[model samples]
Target: MDQKTNEEMLMFVEKATAGDKEALETVLLSAQDLVFNLSLRMLGTFADAEDAAQDILLKIMTHLSSFQKQSAFSTWVFRIAVNHLKNYKKHMFAQRPLSFEFYGTDIENGKSGEVPDLTQDVEKSLLAEELKLSCTNVMLQCLDAESRCVFVLGTMFKLDSRIAGEILDMTPEAYRQRLSRVRKKMADFLKIYCGEYGGGKCRCEDRVNYAIQSHRLNPKQLDYTEAGEIPLQTMLEVKKAMEETDDFAQNFAFCKPYEAPERTKRFVREFLDSPQLSVIRNAEGRG
Candidate 1:
C-alpha cells in the first residue's frame, strides 16, 4: 500500500474521529494490510495472524477517539498493533523452538519420510521460495518478542529509529540499541544457516524436499506469503524511497514480506457492515 500524505491522513483522521462511519471504514481498511502483515510476522501462524488482525482492527476502531494525533496516524496505528502483538504473544506463549531445531527433529525422527523428486524447474524454484519463507518465519520466533518486534520494524518495515521508537514507546537511542542487539543475534544465526549470507549448509533448495515430505510446503496451497509480490524494501524515510543494499541481517529478515490474506479483507468489510457501523454513525450524529 502507498503511504498517505499528512494532509490526506489528517482528513481521514478528522472524519473518523468525528465518527463518520465511511471515513472510519476507509481509515481502517487502508491499514488492513499493515496490521495483517505485522500480525503474521509477529505471530508466525495464519490462524493467529488472522485473529490478531481482527482484534487489532477492533481495537483501532474502539480506540479511535483516543488517538491524540501526537504522531502520524500510521504510527499510532502501529503502536496499537505492536503492543497488541506483544501481549498476544505472551498470552499465546509463542516462543517455540527455532526452525532449525524443528526441522532437525523432524528429519531425524524420519517424520518427513521419503523425499519426492520434483523434476520441474518451475516447481523447484517455487518450493525453494516457500522453504525460504517458512524457514525465515520460524527463525523469527527464536528471538524474544521485544527483539522480534524491533528487528521487524527496523529491518523489514524499514521504519526509522525515531518513528519505530514512537510505535514501541521507546526513545530513539533505546530503539537503536535494541535493534543493534537483535541485528547481531539474527546476523549470527543467518551467517551460520543462510547460504546467501555465507556458505551455510542449510540452503533453501536443500530443504525443499524435506519441507515437502514433512507437509510444510504444499504446492497447491502456498501459505505464509504471496506469490509475485516484491518484499518491502528497507525504506527509512517516510516520504522518500531509498535503495535497499545487502545488509546480511536485513536481507535475511526481509526475504519474504507478509501478504494479507483475503479473509482479513473480508473480515474488515463485514465489520464495516455490522452494527458497529451504527455505533460510529450515531456517535457522529451526537458530535
Candidate 2:
C-alpha cells in the first residue's frame, strides 16, 4: 500500500507503540538530527543535548497513544520536545552545573568562547561551535518556555507559525508576536556579534544570505527525494521518481550534491540494502 504523507510516519509510530524495536529505531534515524539540533540549542550542552534527545524519544514512545494527530506530525513531535525542555530546565535550576566549557573554554558567565578566525572573506562566525554555543545560550536565556517552544519550532525547524502556535497552544497572533520577539532578540545578538550583519563583528545572517545566494535552496541543487547512496534497485527507483516529478527535482535539488563520500561507501552499501524507501520511490513514479 502506498503511504500518504504522514501516513507512513504515523504507521511507523504505531509499530513502535506495538514494541517494534526496529520501527522505533527507524523513526529515530529519520529524526535524529532534528532531535539533536533542538536539544543542542535548547540545553546548550552537547552532553545534555544527547540526554535530552534520547529521553524525549523514549518519552514519545511511551506516550505515542496520546498523539491523536490534532496537528502536523512534526508539530506533535516538537510538542514532546517542548515538554522535555521544561523538565530539563527544572533539572538545570535544581542542580546547576557551575563549570562548563564554551567552544572548549571556561567562560566566566557562559559566553561563547571567542569566535574562531573567520573564513578569510566571510568575516562571520560561520556557525562554528563556539558561536552556536554563544548565540544559542543567549537566546535560551532570553526566552520563557512558550517563547522558546515557538522559537525552536518556527525558526529553527522552519515549521509554520500556525503549526507552532498549535503546538504551543497559542493564538496565531500570539505566536506571531513571540516569533517577532525571537527575531528581535536574534537580531540583537547578531548586532552584537557581527555588527549589523558582519560589518565589524561576525554574523550568521551573512552565512544564511550566502547560502541563499549560492542557490543552495534551489531545488535543482539538491536531490533529497532521490535518496542517493542506496542500492542499485533503490537507485533505479529514485531515478525513476526523479524523472516523474518536476516538484521532486526542485525540492530535492539541494540534496543532490550530498552523494555519499567514498569513505563511507562500504557502510552505505549495506544501508542501501533496505527496501524501505523503494516503495515510496516506486509510488512517486506512478504518480
Highest TM-score against the true fold, candidate: 1
lDDT of each: 0.69, 0.47
Per-residue lDDT tens digits for candidate 2, residues 122-236, read 3343333233333335335445555666555554444555666676788777777777666565555444444333223443343433333332222232222232333222111
* Candidate 1 positional error at 75, Å: 0.9
For each candidate, give its TM-score against the true structure: 0.82, 0.54
lDDT of 1 by residue, 1-287 (tens): 33566567668878987767778777777777778778877877666788899899888887787888787777888889999998785433364445546544543454233667642344777778777776677677777778889878877777877788878889988888888777777777666657745445566676676776665677666674453343453111255322232355435644455556778878888988888778865775676
RMSD in angstroms between candidate 1 and the native structure over all alpha carbons: 4.1
Query: What is the TM-score (0 to 1) of candidate 1?
Result: 0.82
Name the regions of candidate 2 deviating beyond 4 angstroms: 1-4, 90-139, 193-287
